[model samples]
Target: MTKPVIVVPKGMEFIRDEIGYAPAVLANGTLYIAGQIGRDDSRQLVTDKEAQFVQVFENMKRVLAKAGGDFDNLVEMTSYHTDMRDLPLFMQVRDRYMKGVLVAWTAIGAAQLCGAPGYFLEVKAVARID
Candidate 1:
């Protein structure tokens, strides 16, 4: 069996050292991504909700790209949202990024996230890579 490869995209600033986890791991043609939040390349949390949603997907995109995959490669996703009412807005931004790349998804409503007061949502994904 091939060993897992930790994927760390260039120019992406995730606090993996402090968090004690890799942002993504590739093994056996599958890429497992850690939960991504709205933090930008500078590590600052985006304030706008819609923009934050976009940032979340963009962050995942970077990890996927590092694994030689794209949105179409995504096979599964699980998202946690602080507010259920934001689903509609989140979907709008998601569709724009996904661009018809469908995947099995589960959305969960949470009272708060780990980095609360700033983070509104988090998304974790799995993708198949050739």
Candidate 2:
């Protein structure tokens, strides 16, 4: 059996160290990326909807890149939203990165995300690494 390889990109060490969870795990050529919030480089939750969406995708990209894949490699994605009305803006930001890549996606409206308020979205995904 192949063992899982933990993929934690630079600047995300706090998640593993302080938060005690891997950002992503790669096993059997499959990469499971943990849900990413709209946190900036300093780990501050983003304020606006559009910029927050961009940061979320950027955070996801870091994990994907660290796991040897890109947005095109994503096979599945799940997004939890605090407000369904923000879907339009979220889709716009998502399309900017996922541009020609077709991946199964599910957008769900939730009461809250990441056990925190002020965060509008959280994105989790699975990717095929070669």
Best by lDDT: 2
Worst 10 residues of 1 by lDDT: 11-20
The C-alpha TM-scores of every prediction are: 0.94, 0.97
- Tens digits of lDDT, candidate 2, 1-130: 6999999999999999999999999999999999999998798989888899999999999999998899999999999999999999999999999999989999999999888789899999999998
- lDDT of candidate 1 over 41-88, digit per residue (tens): 888899999999999999998899888989999999999999989999
Badly placed stretches (over 4 Å) of model 2 are: none
Residue pairs with clashing backbones, model 2? none
Cα lDDT computed for each candidate against the true fold: 0.89, 0.94
